[model samples]
Target: MQDRNVYTIQQLSAFSGLTVRTLRHYDDLGLLPARERNSSGHRLYSRSDLLRLQQIMFYRELDVPLSEIAEIVDDPDFSLTEALERHRKRIGAEISRLQKLIATIDTTLHTVNQETMSDRTNEELLYDGFSKEQIEEINAEVDLTYDPAIVAESRKRAKVMTKKEIEAFKIESSDILNGLIAAFRRGAAADSEETLKWIGRHVDTINRFYTPTPEIISGLGDLYVQDPRFTEYYDKHVDGLAAYVRKGMKAYAESMRT
Candidate 1:
C-alpha cells in the first residue's frame, strides 16, 4: 500500500469514474490541481484532490460550463469551504424535492399493490407527483428563457400538427434518443463524423416536430441548459451526455446548408 491518502492518477480515475484523459484535461484547464509527483513523475492525488474532484462534479451537475468552472476553481482566492457551503444548500433543496418524489412513488406503489386500485385514474395512480401548477411554472420558465422567434416557430409546428402526428413524431424522437445513448454507451467519439451523422438525425427529429432551423436546432441546446428535467433525461441515459450532444449538434449544424 502506498499511503493512507495518496493515490495515483489512474487510481483516482478508477475511483471517480473519470477518464485519465479527463483528469489531465482538468489539470491542463487548472480546474483540478495535482497533489504531488513521485520520483518517476507520475501525478498523485491526496485527500485534497479527492475533495477537489467532488467539487468539480458538483459544478458539473449544475452544468456550469467547464471553462467557467475552471476559472472559478483555479483562483487563489477560491475557497473549497465556500464551494462546499454552497453545495450543502443546493443539496438540501434537492433532498426536499426528492423526498416529495419518493412520497409520490410510495403512494403509487401502495395503490398498485391493491386489487381495488384498478379503478383509479392514471393521474391518481401516479399520485400527483407534480402539481399542474408546478408544470405551469416550468413552462413559464422555458417560455421566459427560450428565444421568442424560435418558440413561435416551434409552437407553430406543433399547432399545425394533429395529435396522432405528434405521437408518431415522438416515436421517431425516442428512437433517435436511444440511438444516441447506444452510441455513447459503445464509447464512440463524440466528434466523429459518424457521431455527427447521428446528431444530424437528432436535429432532423427536432425539425420535424419543432420546425427548427439548423441554428434554432442548435439553440434548442438550451433545453439541456435551462431545464433540470431535460438534464435528468440525459443523465439517466448517459454520463457526459449534455456536453457530447451539444458538441455534436454544433458540429452537425454548422455543416448544414439548409
Candidate 2:
C-alpha cells in the first residue's frame, strides 16, 4: 500500500506547481533530494520534502538566488519558524510599496483624465507622487552633482513633456529598474553580457530626459551608491541593488569609452 505521507515526483510537482524538469534540477543541485524510491526506482518525496519546497519557493519569490537559498535552508541552526517571521516582514514591506505605487498610478490617472487643462505646471504634474521635501532633496542633489547649465537644460526638457508622457516615462523607467533588479537577484556577474544589456536599456531610458555620455553614465552609477536617497530607493527593491547597478553601469561606460 502506498504511504499517504509520501508522494512521487509527479505527485509532488502537481502539488507544488513546479515543473518536473525544475524538480529534477533541484534534485541535481541537492536542494530537495527525494527520500525514497519505489521498486522501479522512481523518486518519492516525504512530507518533510514538501515543507522544504515551500521554503525554497518562498525564498525564490523574494528573488533570492537558489544557491543562497540552499545554504540558508541547509544551515544546522535554521529555524522554519524564524524564517516564516522574516518572510512575513518582507512581504509586509512589499505590500506597503505596492500600495504606494498604486496611489501614484491613481494620481496619474486622475491627472490624465481631466477634461480641462490643469493649472499645475509640468514639473508639478510630473512629480505627483513625491513630497515637497523629497523633491527639494532631489533637486539639491542634482545641483550639487551637475553644472547649472546642464541642470537647466534637463529641467527645460522635462518641462516640455506632457503629463501622459511623464507617466509613460515613469512606467518605462520602473520596468527597466525591475529588469535590473531581477538580473542582480539571479547572481549574474556585474559585468556580464546580460547585465550590460540591462544597463544599455537604462542608459536609453535616461537619454529621454538628458543626453548621457559614457562619463555621465559612469557618474550616475557612482551617485546611485553614494547618495543616500538613491541607495535607499534601489535597495528597497533589492538589497545591494544600488551597488550591483553601479558595477554594471561602470562596466558599460568603460565598454563605451573603449
Candidate 3:
C-alpha cells in the first residue's frame, strides 16, 4: 500500500542524490525525520520532506553541521534570504583563497620547469606571494615563543616539499581549522568527542611539520592563546576558536599522559 505522493528512502535517495544511509542518519539525528512510516516500517517522505531535504543539502554543502542545520531550518526567525546572502560571502572568500593557492602552485610549477630552478633561492621557490620580509615576520612570530633553531628546522623541512605537497599541507591545515570551527559552532565541550576529533587532526598536522610529544603539544596549545598572531588566526574563524583550540589541545595532551 505505497502512497503515490509519498517516497520511500530509496526513492528519495535516487531523487535527491543522497545515499539512503545518509538520509537515515539525518532521521536518526532528528535533522530530517521521515514524513511517515509504512506498514513494513519503511521510512517515507512527502513533498514537504523533499523541500526540507533540499534545504538540508544546501546547508551541508556549506559545511554546516547537521545539528546547526536543524536549528536554522526549524527556527521561525530563520530567514532563507539571509542565509543565502551569508553563504554568498563565505563561499566567495573561500574561492578567493583557493584562487590564490592555485596561482602559487602555478608559479612553483613554472619555477620547477625553468632551467634557473637550481639558481632560485629557497624563498623564491617556496613562499610564493610572501616577500622575504613577510616570511621573516611569520618566523619572528613563531620564534617569540619557541626556539629560533627549532622554528628554522621546521621551515627547512617545509622548504624541501614540492608544489603539490605544499598545497596538500595547506589543505590539511585548513581542514583542521574548519573542523574546530564546526565543533565550536556545535557547542562541543573542551574534551568532548567532537572536539577531540579536531584535536586529533591538529596533532596529525603538527606531526607533519615536526614530531609532537605530549609536552610539545601542550606548549603549542599555550602558544595558541598567548601569541597574538596565533590567537588572531584561530579567533578570526570564530569569536573564541583560539581558546577552544587551546583547551582541546591541552586536554588531548593530558589524555596522552594518562
- Runs in model 3 with CA error above 4 Å? 1-5, 85-150, 160-211, 218-258
Best by lDDT: 2
So what's the TM-score on candidate 3? Answer: 0.51
lDDT by residue (74-113, candidate 1, tens digit) is: 7889999888999999988778777888988887777768
Worst 10 residues of 1 by lDDT: 122-131
lDDT of 2 by residue, 70-130 (tens): 9999999999999999999989877876676677677677767874345667325545455
Q: Clash number for every model?
A: 0, 0, 0
Number of the top-ranking candidate, with TM-score as the measure: 1
Q: Tell me model 3's lDDT, rounded to 2 decimals.
A: 0.81
TM-score of each predicted structure versus truth: 0.61, 0.51, 0.51
* Model 3 pairs whose backbones collide: none
Q: Give per-residue lDDT, candidate 3, residue 109.
A: 77
What TM-score would candidate 1 get against the native? 0.61
In angstroms, how far off is 9's CA in candidate 3?
1.3
